[model samples]
Target: MQPIALITSPFTDKFSIPRQPGLAPSVISTVSFVGDFDHTASIEGIQQYSHLWLIFEFNQHRSHQWRERVRPPRLGGNKQLGVFATRSPFRPNNLGMSVVKLVDVVVKPQIKLVVSGADLLDQTPIVDIKPYVPYVDAIPEASSAFAGDEPNQLEVCFSATAEAFIDELTSNAAKSEHYQNLRQVIIEVLRQDPRPAYHASKQPERHYVSQLYDLELNWYVTGQCLTITEIRQQKDF
Candidate 1:
């Protein structure tokens, strides 16, 4: 299918993205229509809905071969399950769907949508967009064996230097409003302990780097606490 739009997300790479939408509600994204789909009239009634379903392609994994059996992150990425049973990006079509909150719809300045809780990567192609109808989309009797409940979250903390850096970034009036909630976004993402299951088990004390927006986060885990050692702009690296 042809892409109707493309999304610009805070997640620059796959490592720091939440396993599911709404897991990190502060992460926002912008969907810009493209080609013939860039008409404001096409999204005239979009504001009526509180949420939307974004049908996007897993473009990053399109080249990889699809697997019938895959390990789900929820199962610690150890147990194998059928691909259809899990939301693994490796699929025949490499397609993914996410439900994101509709923060705003800009019509005057072309067609653009401000959405929150998106799990899409930067410049991800969007094939379709649909309104999330709670009446039918949400099923009360839904149940899953592998993912029965939300995963446990770690305690996320920042070092004094990291805190000072964040304060400086938000201190400027030009960047303050845009970055006011950057700290919360980082906390939510880090608290989820976005590490490979094997790394968590084998190298719990190892330092790691994750990219969020244009910032590079240096962090490490000890016991149930994840600490941020430093935060740097990607340009400085």
Candidate 2:
């Protein structure tokens, strides 16, 4: 099938979309459809679905060929497993499926969708969209192997400098709400630890940076733990 258009957002790069949505609710992103189309009419019944299944291109891996076996991050980045068993992006089709919360839809010259918990990078091509059905999709008894039982929560403390910057952003009338939610989401996602398990032994004082929306995060690793020390707008990067 021919791709209709590309969809871009500011929430993350190709590497940043979490394995699943709701894992980071503070991250808000917009999907802008490209090219000429009846944006308003195409999304007429979209509001009816609380969630949407986004079939998007794994643009980062598009140029790379697929591998039969892959290492899963949850498996500590070691040992090989059949590619089909893991959600590795290095696939033959270079496609990704993510279920995201459809918060709002605005129709103008082009359809702009406000989505939450999206794992797609900016300018990624959207292949398709499908409504999620609770009856057919919910599987409470399903088991998670490498994912373990429940997610481990981390303690997060921001540096004074980061707090002050956040305060200034929050005080701004135009960006207060967006900045507040963005800060919380970025903190939560980074706190979960994004480092590869094999790289866990690296220097603990090193800092890592990640961009979400307009925020640029400066985080540090301590005792194999991750912490956010600073957050600033991307313009400052």
**Lowest summed-lDDT stretch of 10 residues in model 1?**
171-180
At residue 105, what lDDT does model 1 achieve?
86
Q: Largest TM-score belongs to which candidate?
A: 1
Write candidate 1's Cα lDDT for 27-113 as tens digits.
878999999999977997899999999999999997799999999988888999999999999899999999999998887656899
Pairs that collide, model 1 = none
Q: Candidate 1 at 121: error in angstroms?
A: 0.6
The number of the candidate with the highest lDDT is: 1
lDDT for each candidate structure? 0.90, 0.73
Clashes of each: 0, 2
Candidate 2 — which residues are off by over 4 angstroms? 12-16, 148-150, 177-180, 223-225
lDDT of 2 by residue, 100-170 (tens): 89988877756888888776677778878889888888788888788756455556668889888888887
